[model samples]
Target: MSPGTNVVIALAISSIVIVVISFRNKLVYRQRRELHGCEVPPSLPQLDPVFGLDLILSRFTSLKADRRNVSLLEQFRRHGNTFQSITFGRTTFFTIEPRNLQSVLSTDFLSWGVEPMRLFAFEPFIGKGIMCSDGAFWEHSRALIKPTFARTQIADLHLDDFGVHVERLIDLIPKDGSTFDLQPLFARLALDSSTEFLFGESVQTLAPDLTPSSAESFLEAYDYGQSCVGRRIQLPKFNFLTTDSRFWKSCQTAHEFVDQQIQKALLVTSKQKQDVDGRSRYILAQELLRQTHNLLDIRHQLLNIFLPAHEAIGVAMTNIFFNLARHPRIYTKLRNEILVADLKARTLTFERLKSLKYLQFVINETFRLNPTIGTNTRMALKDTILPTGGGPSGHGTSPILVRKGDSVVFGFYGLHRMPNVFGDDVDVFRPERWEKLRPAHWSYLPFGGGFRVCPGQQLALTEIGYCLVRMVQAFERVENRDPTMEFVEHYKITTESKNGAKVAMVPSHL
Candidate 1:
């Protein structure tokens, strides 16, 4: 044999030996960490067909609901609560487990962060707002808005703007008995209220005789911009070839609408101080400017609050109304609950509203079945560990190893509907279940959990609950135009009825 050929063979053998030794060293280090309790348990069991055409196909297959979420639920049902996978070229860890949830979202929150992809996708509209940005920016943003979202401020809005919108909504309803998709009506109602609550000037979406309908374009822009953000996240981030001109157009429209509002608020604020109407119903922009004069910063924060607050609140009301339409029995039961409270008060206040237990149960039930923002997807900022699904040695109580750059997605619908946490009839909507089934905080996240929990949670609940109670108070009957309920495909922004929820209203003799 030639000396050159022998040298090449020798080099190949040496390379193989080096690889083997490196592998052995890594295995030994992992074992040492596990024994010393310095690290989480071994890696978790990965879900099959992890990231490829098959996974994508399964996700898009079900047109009945958010196919991606439906796919996640199917996997959880098959492979315990915590399962690891590779999705869109990134290592992803998904969990519906209570303990793991507490770790990822609360206890070890510093270890995990909001997926950067989300920040980039939403940056066009929300900018460096609290929802997408983290660290000092998130802290600063949270601090500035915290005071404005106080209970007293929320109560004032509920009592004033919210009540006004619902009254206009009643007038808009046709007594001619024709069924209309109530989702748009609810959106219009929510938009009108959110405008006054956030901007200090009602957009007058209801087109009342005294006011003109002016916000139609603004609402359209907001919806398109948000939905595009959802779509962008679903697409592969590394793919340079991908582009959406339409999404940018929507962004322009939304930015123009919001920017105009911000300028108007600034012009007004410059002239005179806003009246402190006891509860402080100052426009959010004015309150925001008190902390910073940066128009860009103000624009982002205001947009962040406006878009999701508008879309999510609207969807919540629509779904609750849709569900109530199907279950007239729940309507009557809730109305009775409201009437009993009615005798004790001249008008309902936030405190009085909180006292209505059954109303809360209904609200809880609605949020459980349809969490508007279903998944809480986060990324690992550093090498970390999840609390469970670490396989045999500890009966899955062992911690699961998570690598930096990996994603942790908390599917709310899957978690909330888990049989172990919520009981056997998890899929069924039973308001009474709130009576018997009480799960851990992380397990029952409707507006997320821990430090990153939704800031507008109280405000959203007040509006949704207050609207429903007042709705049932004014009208006796909520009849479904269709016998069955159907859900639209998920846009990642929020869910809606596939076909608008058609319903008929009948007055109850007051």
Candidate 2:
């Protein structure tokens, strides 16, 4: 035979082998599904199955209309607890079922990883840190930073250090009950306190006169960079399309500020100026410095903690005030609880704050309505089965097949609003419900769960509780100033009100 004829024959054999292997794999998968009683979850209706351009456009439209949460909740309502959709020719699973969440987050954790989220989205912005990495790297990152949030460290940092920032925040509140937005002030407070916590130096954004030019620039760049990161995460598969020169510039500015802080810590370490052995003072950057001197590692780890620390606390405070303003009765009740407790006479330590049941309830209700990190996505590292969220009707009572490389997206916002768990009045903001509410495990994850649960949970709760108590103590009642009493979402890495929490406060002395 001629050379060309021989080549054609070889190509035909390769094609035959490929087809045979594909068929065999399908057969094996089918047999496994049958054996395990796995079924495909219901598919979301999509106009374009190949690229899912329609789904993407619809999402962008919902976001622009400020109804992202509404749209997402509607999907779970229509498709039940679990469903599948095609995005860029890849099958993505969506679930709000607590059992499935338990499986993905804990029981079957090893079969999933956050590699896609890290590589496609966060690494470019935050670098590879604990929140961004998976597997061994994530484990190492967690171990290195966990000590900084130890009970001893958090308690030591609270009270004296936290009170200063709270005083500044209160001083800014209007005395005349004039309408004002608390969201911006909350952001400033969070940035100030978070910097102090992480770097042992506060940016002091709340104190304009004391703020430096570099600090102002850092705040600007950091805010812009985080906003951009939020958008990139929204479309992680298309991050390249979202990022631009401005985004890169912002990331660089934020990096420079962090790098400067790292240098200061390094200088202190080199001179033996910091009493590392005594554990007298705890700074996240210094703690990281003790672990490794790698500038990038330290910067990334600090940024990772700072991002959540800043955003979560700020967002939580803003939402808490948002609800408190609209729900005057609840606010009054909460305030009465605080006053009756006489926390002023006693030092408000970490344990003391945790004992305030009503305050805890209010915080819990706020988190349920608007979790800081609303929706999260994870990728399957291997073929696995979700505990439920399958079958013909998709009632979420049958095991579902999850293939390798599939993306599983869970909406905590929806999970928190489950009628069966939270009652038919899930839409209402009633902190009293938490009095007897016992949501199943994995159902209420304001700070997330499993091995990757937030290391900063205790610190976050403490800061939020301290701020809430101080605000309530100073203000007799909160009045909603916005025309609408409803909560609108301004979602990013976290969700806050689109319409700033506009409200007036009645001074307690009056």
Candidate 3:
């Protein structure tokens, strides 16, 4: 009885183990097949390091200068528009040509969807925010928010509010002849402006008695969000488990702050009746809550607006200010234009600011040199062929087959700096180029292009323009304290100045 029972039990256990192992092997094989179908081109001459899995895992999360990324464009210059490789995880098709960009963004936008891995990384913090979401959800969110910025008349209101914020910033500038870090100051200003505009209340981030704890928490959350994305991309298996870990604790802090502010805005909006002019100026949170009774939808929309609204504006402003500090001539030109415009009206108004062509040029130039959103990625939702012109620099006429699920990275930095698009002096800070040549729309996409272009671009431009104008108007002379300030191009979300911009501001004579 013992021998028969023992033999039966042993055989059953072995059979179960075999089935499980076979199933596991099948899953792995399927995944490998899906990956290989993406059809990444053979490694280019320069892709010696990217081919190694160990090297990618080690250096993927590293913030050091990626010569590999940089060289993709250089290879394009030497070889043409299309280059190929598998980096990080998926097969990639990189394009710098305007025609290709237009095709990807405009003509066949649906075919090239947001990259799964990138979206997976971003989902933790931003959730399905309009920036990350696609398809119907994106359409719904965009429809709801589009009207807020669609009116031509709101331009004046935008500028006027921006001026008030700028005045607050000017007051905060130190007159002690002591050098101060402008990065934090610009960051605060951008944050304050975004909060005020989005929620109808200011965090007073730029105030003299800035609340250090709140600022630190905000920054910590932002950095945490950025790091979480990078970490998720590198380690997919541990994503959900690690999302709530200490690395993302600061994200919780940020969420709490955002929720509190949104709640406060809702309360205020609830109390107010539609004004005689139909202008009930309340926080976007309040406006959104009033319109939608659905709790889950409300939460999603709030998160969507808060994440991108706060950081995108901040990053854009930081880049613009960094450029202004580095190129004083551009600053001087911008200031003179503002001063002349301001004097003619006896006061600075939003309408008047639009006439300052040089200001627009400066903003455009900043975008060209240092885009706030540097990289865009897409996943092939279906088997598609991306038409390739040639190798990195080659003019070969060939259409590259991009299988479904392949990841495609559109290098905004590489495309913006392309000599064919921007001319040979692409690296130089020349606002005059905007006057001389009109760039193809996709070539200079700081706010991105096509179906998912940033909804807040107008507001961002207004806020940035106001800040630049006021800073230039208030300071007679501004000089960079750190002339050797290096650009930190490879941060998780934002490109930051490695050394915070230190500047000396001399008061202007009226």
Candidate 4:
């Protein structure tokens, strides 16, 4: 054959190969769908369907408007409990259905992995540990950290140690009842408490007289890194284009701080030369060292644990106070309950805090309205079927085929707002609803569900409860000071009020 003819033949072969490879996954999916009686969920109508450029642009727009969660909830409202959309050309499944979430997070949990985008986004600051790893590594990380939060450790709230920080928090409040933002104070309190709990010493960001320049730098760096990581998670694939020198510096500073703590803990351990039972002491750094003496590994694990604990505790407290300030009647009721019980700071144990039924209701309602981690995504590791989101109507109760590599996005915010599960007044902040409300399984995942459920859940709730009871005890009344009564979202690694918990307190003595 002539050279031209040979070239044409090669081009034809290449075309055939491309077509076969592209259709192979679809053919497999179709076979599975037919065999299992699965159907595709409704797809979001997109002008740029192939690349989903329209969806991508709209996401950015929603983000800029500071309504990303609202925009997502609206999509569910229009589509149904479960729907499909092309996000930046990737096939994505969005679901607020309990059944589907149950499968993804628990029943068939192994079939899904941590969304790679999240790992990519978080690894720079947190490195590879529980929060950013999957498979055996995640399992190992979980196993390593589990003992640190064992029942014995978590129950020992060390009220005396924590009370000191709460006292500092209360002192910072204006005595004359001037308006103040509680968000930052909450953040500092969380950081100080978490550091002391995990590192064997507090950074003491809340104590200006005690905090050194290095401590302040560490706090600022961690905060900056967290903000950067939050942005990076949104567009992980293109993070290179967005990341800057400052983010790198912040990561370095945060790492150095953790490294210093690791060294101190190691030195203490060596001097004592005792097999420290981390579960007995509830110190994360010491526990991590017991697992592995590798300095970098310990640093990564510490930061990973710190990120969620700090963000979750801080943001939850802020939202709780935000709601409390606006709802004076509920606040009064909560105070009465605490006062009636005659609980003191010294007596605030894990069991006693849990016994505060109304306080638990308020916390539940706040989390239902504003989950700290609003939306989470998981990547399908193998072809599987979700129990719902199928059939011709798109909302039909049939299994939906989820192909390997597809992304599953579940929104706790939307799930918590389901009319059927949470009632018609889903938007209203009503603590009384929890009195008789029992949401469907997997529908009320404030701390998530399944094997990967936050190990820090108990500790976080205890911390929030401890501080909340203290605040209520210290003040006669909490008054909303912000002109805007609505809770506007300020998204970071976690979500908090954009306008913050701006309020004034009437000191009980006054």
Please name the candidate that would achieve the greatest lDDT relative to the true structure. 4
Instruction: In model 4, state the lDDT of residue 88.
Output: 60
lDDT of 4 at 332: 94
As for candidate 4, its clashing pairs are none
Tens digits of per-residue lDDT for model 4, 103-179: 98899999998847578788888899998788888987888888877655454545566788999999999979889
TM-score to true structure, per model? 0.87, 0.93, 0.83, 0.95
Off by over 4 Å in 3: 1-42, 45-62, 66-72, 87-89, 210-216, 234-244, 269-282, 343-351, 390-394, 483-486
The reply for model 4, stretches above 4 Å from the true place, is 1-12, 240-243, 270-280
> What's the CA error at residue 188 for candidate 3, in Å?
1.3
lDDT of 2 by residue, 5-120 (tens): 99999999999999999899779888988999989889988889978999999988988887777788899988898899998767898899888888888989999888666655
Clashing pairs in 1: none
Question: Whose TM-score is greatest here?
Answer: 4
Quote the positional error of residue 384 for candidate 3 in Å: 1.3
lDDT pick, better of 1 and 4 = 4
lDDT of each: 0.74, 0.83, 0.67, 0.85
- Whole-structure CA lDDT of model 2: 0.83
- Given candidate 3, what's the lDDT at residue 28? 65
Order the candidate numbers by TM-score, best to worst. Answer: 4, 2, 1, 3
lDDT of 1 by residue, 1-510 (tens): 899999999999999999999799669758755764543322334354446555555555653345656667777776667666566556676677778788887899888877375787788756778878777888888888887875465554456667778888888886666787788888888888877777667788886764433377777777777766776666666433135676677677777777777777877735234345644455677788778998888878888788678866788888788788888898889999988777322256666677899999999998898778777788888878776766633225667666678788778979888887788998777899988777878789888888887788878887777788877877888888975565544554665655667898887688
TM-score result, candidate 2: 0.93
